[model samples]
Target chain A: MSKNEETEKSDVKDSTAAFEEALAKTKDKKYVLHLYVAGMGPKSIQAIDNIKRIFDEYLPGKYQLEVIDIYQNPVFAREGQIVAAPTLIKELPPPLRKLIGSMSDTERVLLGMDLISKPNENDEKQQE
Target chain B: MIEEKDRTLKEKSLEKAPTGINGLDDITYGGLPKGRTTLVYGSAGSGKTLMAMEFLVKGAQKYGEPGVFMAFEETAEDLAENFASLGFDLDGMESRDRLLVDHVHIDKSEIEETGEYDLEGLFIRLGLAIDSIGAKRVALDTLEVLFSGFQNEAILRSELRRLFRWLKDRGVTAIVTGERGEASLTRYGLEEYVADCVILLDNRMEEQISTRRLRIIKYRGSKHGTNEYPFLIEEDGISVLPITSLSLEHEVSTERISTGISRLDTMLGGQGYYRGTTVLVSGTAGTGKTSFAAQFCKAACERGERCLYFAFEESPDQITRNMKSIGIKLQPYLDSGLMQIHASRPMAYGLEMHLMGMRKILDTFNPDVIVIDPITNLISAGTEIDVKLMLTRLIDYLKLKNITAICTSLVQRESTEGINAQEISSLMDTWINLRFFESNNERNRGISVVKARGMAHSNQIREYMLTNHGIEIRDVYLGPSGGLLMGSSRDIQEAKETAEIAAQSKNAARRKRELESKLKSLDAQITALNSEFEVQKEELDKLSSEEALRSNALAKDRSEMARIRRADLH
Candidate 1:
């Protein structure tokens, strides 16, 4: 990765450790997430499935997920400032984060949600 | 499928949506394309966002077409606050369901792109906003911000193309603004997507002065003005000036108005300037150009017509006071609301601002006559071409409205004969040239008509005075040196002419008396000669009688001998 990404990685590493310590002290820390999608498209389905599976494996009943279809509830799109469909917004856990595209990349999702600090091999591919 | 047939059937005639901005519709032949996307790209602070918003606001307010403004840069509250000063009630429009504003905030630092995605959420929000208000017009102010929010260029590009097609399919006229690029029309090449029409706004600085210009780069299925027109952004809105009225086909009126001075009127074809014509009064410094314009303004007001005066060099108080010195009382007309005076320094703003301000005044005042005193001061605001272009459009507009206009120009003393107000002189209908006559060690003012279209005007240069009463045009006076005389020199010439007439009459009377005396002497001498002839005749007659008597006595003696002589005679 470039210099900025490396520095950002080190910063994320420092913050992730502090967040994990707080989570351990609480022992009941919950993640609040809102996924905005358009109707029943394939990307929306894939995103819903991928995020649910990750939450089950890691969060394990310690999270709340609201799947909003902008086609039916278009008002949420404006409120969430969503341009691309299948966008995941972590509204809880202090610092807010927005992840665009389907939740197909688990490492990026975890990094975006502050679950992990280190980036996967995908960072090298992006740099190339 | 039915819409495809409908479009094909009406492809020959493209309908338009009239942008209520001043002077923009005239150059666009009407306005922007209806149910089409127009790409407006410009550099930073070039007024692209303002122009697009004005288009939407004017459409909603004037055309009764509800609009949706999807701002990608400024927030909804900020946009409303910024436009509040321009008299646009955005908050009120939203309440009345006439307009809708949706700000799409996207921060690059907060976004993390992972995998495949499509911009379907934007379409949903935009569709919801439009359907809520039945909006016919939409504005996407700087949509290129989405490029930074999303990392995939291919997805962004395809999504933009789909968005424009979607806007067209919905039959909503849209304006998409983009930041100007170095080698292309937009930073992200947005022009390639929204290709139905494109407009470019530019703000250029020359000689430490800034001017805003707008040009239509392309307009499909329509003809538009190709020149870069100067535009102004005032407290109200943007106004583009369509310079160079394309034709000389404006209608002419036969009505005549007085020039306030009867002698000057007589010199100008025994009437005055035409009712809806432009009169150029050109002269050097202190040659009475302003005074001449004031006289015309007074005349226009005397006929119960409203007159607007634009003074570039003098203040309203100064003009009124100076005019009072020449017996023109403008205070009453001002109080009665028949006259208005707008005075400002020529360098107070750019030439476009001046023109736009004057246009606004013309709208509010609706004066029948306008006077621009000393247009030479405007030269400091811009170049010669700029001034000329501005004046041409101004004169053309005034004529079209049937408003009589008088423009005064100041020329240099040495170059007045050749220059004569430079390029602006040819655009005038009647050109009155005031000059200074330097002779006999004194300077005086003389006035003449250089050219007066459609009238018989005087060719003689008459000396005019700004006396205590008003302007007075004197008769042509020829000096002894065979040139036009003025001032004290004219007075001296008049006196000398009067003395010459008296001397010629006196000499003729003297010769007549001398001839009368000679006739009396000749008559007396003829009488004396006649008396002498009669006396000599009487003496001769008396002598002849005496000789006759003596001859008779001798005949008596000779009678006796005559008898014998008589017999020989028989």
Candidate 2:
């Protein structure tokens, strides 16, 4: 009976460690988001579409993406809160961020999203 | 239902709504009780509508409380346009949802009331408007207009009571505008009795000048200013100036301001009138009273002290030209913004309104000297007593501010000499009387310093000449003759004539003395001659006796020397 109680105590300690690790991850990694649009018109439609595409590109596995129509919501349109039709929100990642205009600037978007490190000389040359 | 113990334990709380007007809030302690109805009753053109609208707009703009205005006399658009000149941006406020304006059209010809009909229609409209914008202030622009449409006073009275009670129940401050009755505070005395607060506005014209006065007759559960307040409707909206409480603690200034004329200043204690002193220049017409006041304003402007000229009779341009003719040179001062001329006919408005406008200008300009050219013009706008009270209040106000004030009064010859004069001469610290006298078949202007408080003034009357170069006050023409036209030349001529007459008299007296002395000497000479003759005769006789012998001879001389000599003579 004493041996059985010791095994139960060890199982309890493992489960507690796993629970603490999950809590630590949630506390450290903050959700990051970005919305882009061309203008207040419907052509900016696919900008949100493209952002959802990017969300499907890398962050689709575990992130949340929101589509905003700047024309209908003009209050958020002028500030570049949205620059392109498609925008992505990496809600699962830490420290929120944004990318504006066309999603063609993917590396910049990735950099803005903190998905990549500071670009090297070669990366800069490639971007140019 | 609560029992007696529960009722005793309940807390009594009262809410107050503030009227965002300067000095008015202090007069009303805190403000009118919230959710209570206030009746603002006034005669025609007494600024009732203006006052009510101002209260609502001020509440909405200054206190962040939305307001609802219901007008029965004028449409909302017309009302807005009317107030546009007064700088009230009602449209902007309405766009911001801070104010709601509802116009109710009541046709007097078609309205009929029977039995008990609820005023629920008005309530519903007001409620909808208030609810739409969450208004905290409400104004019914003229409840009397509603009464005109219906002849039933009993129904109207009950409806009004219900309206007040309903407003109170709604917990919103309301202002109900009403027309003043011919002999009562309000046309329907019922409104006055029902209102928690009652205000009366009066518009009267005396001597053709119009004035507006506001008085708070009753304020329940609050301390309010009891005296009548003066209000003005101008480009900047309506302003109500509560009368300043009379306090003896107001500080006095020892500073003095020049009276333009050096001789006049010298007569005023060698300095000038004391600061804040009310100087009165009173006289019959054509006394240059207005000119004297203008001279002071001109001097003040030249000294870099701002001055305001309030001309009730003359247009500003006319006054400027007149002053220029007198060599006053007010143009330069006006160009420099040192002098401001406000010209208006006293009959253009009511007396209280004029007073209010004067107060407002004084407040805005903060002038060092305020000159009212012939304040007597205001008499046309009010009764004698009203004018006196207004002048008294105005003088008191000026004294409180320590501003030098000059007021002129035009007195007719008969009035000035009459026992009951219409002029405000008693309230002046300095009274200067101007008069015209006929002398030498010519009209002459004379000014005399009647009284100067705290100073000794010349008792002599000075002759003033209005010339191209301004007023020239010649030396007191101290001629032997009383007429003003007896200039110095006349005095000299009189002196020379007297001297010649005295010389003639002296010569005549000398001649008389000479004649008398000559007579006396002649008489003595005669007596002496007689004595000599007698003595000679006696001697002759003696000699003759001695020479009787010899003589008879002398035959006596008949000669007795023939007599001798002729007694010679013979």
Candidate 3:
């Protein structure tokens, strides 16, 4: 029984190592995001929570999110060209993209970042 | 809800923040409300930015209050250059920590709004500036640029309300300038938010004359002037004119001043015009209205009192040249700075604007007397009501300050006979009408005092004569038929009267000579008669002597009988 338990523990450790290696490899494609917000109004808090949820569910531990309150850090706000609060900026990506509004529409946010494909009708329009 | 709070706050405090603008303090009683926001809205080039800048600069310099100017449209350097001519120490004040200027460079194309946001960054910046300088006043030169750049207007509105409230809480008087709207007071209708006070500025052109007008639309819990006041943006800054006093409670004087021509002075109330009264010199063209006014100005200047001559039809050099012909030495006064001759065409500005310019001159020069050479020239610039209203206000203000004014009005030749004094009677405290009377194929000048409010003036028409010395008023010459005569007819009548006097004196001399001759002849006749009688008496005496000798013997006897008869007769 001790040998079998040791074998199980070793298998679990191997699986954890494999998972770490996979995470490290996926980190190369990680998303670096900044959510600029005014104080925590309903929409600002919602946007922060929504973007966090989308990143956690889709990319797991591959994304780094920095939340900045414009009221507290106005310098950052000015330097980032953040005119409105609850703004999401994909900072590290070569094609930097900005998403404005409450993050209620996950599909649209993904489409703005080119993370998703539209339905068949969009493809037909592109072909034309 | 904001209005209610503003009203309550105003009533509780009754505090004021003085704006060191010319004549604006008097109109606002003290100034804008203390620790409250004022909305200043105006069209382009209406001096809005200049006015706001002046407010801040003056606040720091004169009121002992530091100010912060946050401009969204103009850069700090641009502002500094714009106000350099006004001689404001903007850079000095900024260096001394009394003034802080922030320019928010905004480009609409560059701005990208993504979500809900407040203008908290601006608030923080303004707060930091205020905190650094311990500012007591704050001004946002223009908010239109922000509006144009920002996409979420709802957020901006909320932020504006919050910002104003924050300013109130910060205990700083604030001025927020905005672009004018088509129908509303401000482009964004922000007047509804800043409810403490709203001032509207307008720049309009009438007949190629540009006039800048300022009017206070709302001043909660305070009584303010409702009329549009004229303001000037000059080298010294914005100067608002106090043309009309809201009240008629001005002190009046009973003192008098000469009208320059001693004869005309005598005709005016037997003394002259009241020292602080307004006189209207109305006449037909070429009847010497300007000459009349020039004489007054000369007399006033000669009295060691300052005088201002505003000539509309002639240039200053022209006026001086023309006046020199009448023995009025205006150049000396000009050199001595006692007399200011400001010559501008009546079409240079609107009537009210002219009054404002006059008011500014009045304040700067502080002249004891003012002469408007031909106030009628302003008629071509505005309606009669406009001219009359401006004149009324001008006169009213002059009277309030105890400054004498002499205004000339030209009447059309075919208008009326005696005087067109009824046209502006309400505005004139004294009216002197000058007319050109045609008599015996010659034109003669006449002056008659139509009205003198507080004193009795001459009712007879005196002929006005302008010579190398000055004006001279002559009494009328009465012809043989009791007809009033002037010009060559007057000379003719005087000659006739002289001839008649000579003829009468000659006749009296002839009659006296005749009477003396007749007396001498009668004396001769009496002497001759006396001689004849004497001769007769001598003959009788000789005869009587002969008879006496013959009767000498009989006399003794007759004497006895005569003695007895005499004794009986005794």
| TM-score-sorted candidate list, best first | 1, 3, 2
Clashing pairs in 3: none
What is the DockQ ranking, best to worst? Answer: 1, 3, 2
lDDT of 3: 0.80
lDDT of 2 by residue, B1-570 (tens): 568667665533446788775445656666666788888888778888887888889899888889999888998899889988877888998999988888776664322221223343466567667888999899998988866765556757887888899898888899999998877677877888888988888866545555566788998876788987655566666555655544446577778777888878877777888888888888777778878888888889878898988999898888889888888778888889888999998877766668778887998999889999878888776778667777776777888888898888877662335412355777788878777776566567777778887777787777786777677677654555664443445456567778879999999999999999999999999999999999999999998788766756655436554433544354
Better of 1 and 3 by TM-score: 1
Q: How many backbone clashes does candidate 3 have?
A: 0
Least well predicted 10-residue stretch by lDDT in candidate 3 chain A:
A76-85
- Note the Cα lDDT for every prediction shown: 0.88, 0.73, 0.80
Model 2 regions more than 4 Å off: A1-128, B1-31, B42-47, B72-75, B103-128, B144-159, B179-189, B202-213, B223-232, B236-250, B313-327, B414-423, B437-443, B464-570
Q: What is candidate 1's DockQ?
A: 0.65
Q: Tens digits of per-residue lDDT for model 1 on B1-570?
A: 999988888885899999899889989999999999988888889998889989989999899999999998999999999999999999999999999999999888898877889999889989999999999999998877766788888898888889999999999999988888888667767665476989999999889788889999999999999999988899988888888534668898999999999998998999999998999898888989889989888988999999999999999999999999999888889989999999999999998788878978998999999999877777788777778899888888888888999899888863456645648988899999988888678889889998999999999889999998889998778876778889998898888889999999999999999999999999999999999999999999999999999989896777678686775533
Model 1 steric clash pairs? none
List, residue by residue over B1-570, the lDDT tens digit for candidate 3: 999999998779668889999867778888888888888888889988887888888888899999999888888898888778789878888999989888875666443444455565577667777887899999997878766777777877877778779988998998888888878666667655565888888887765666678998888767778888777776688877656654578899988999999988788777889998989898888888888898998999889999999889999999888889988768999999999999898876677667777887898999899998877787776666556666777777888889988989887762345445336666788988888788678998888888889887877878878887778887678767876677888878788888989999999999999999999999999999999999999999999999998899787777788787785532
Error of 3 at B509 (Å): 1.7
Interface RMSD of 2: 28.6
lDDT of candidate 1?
0.88
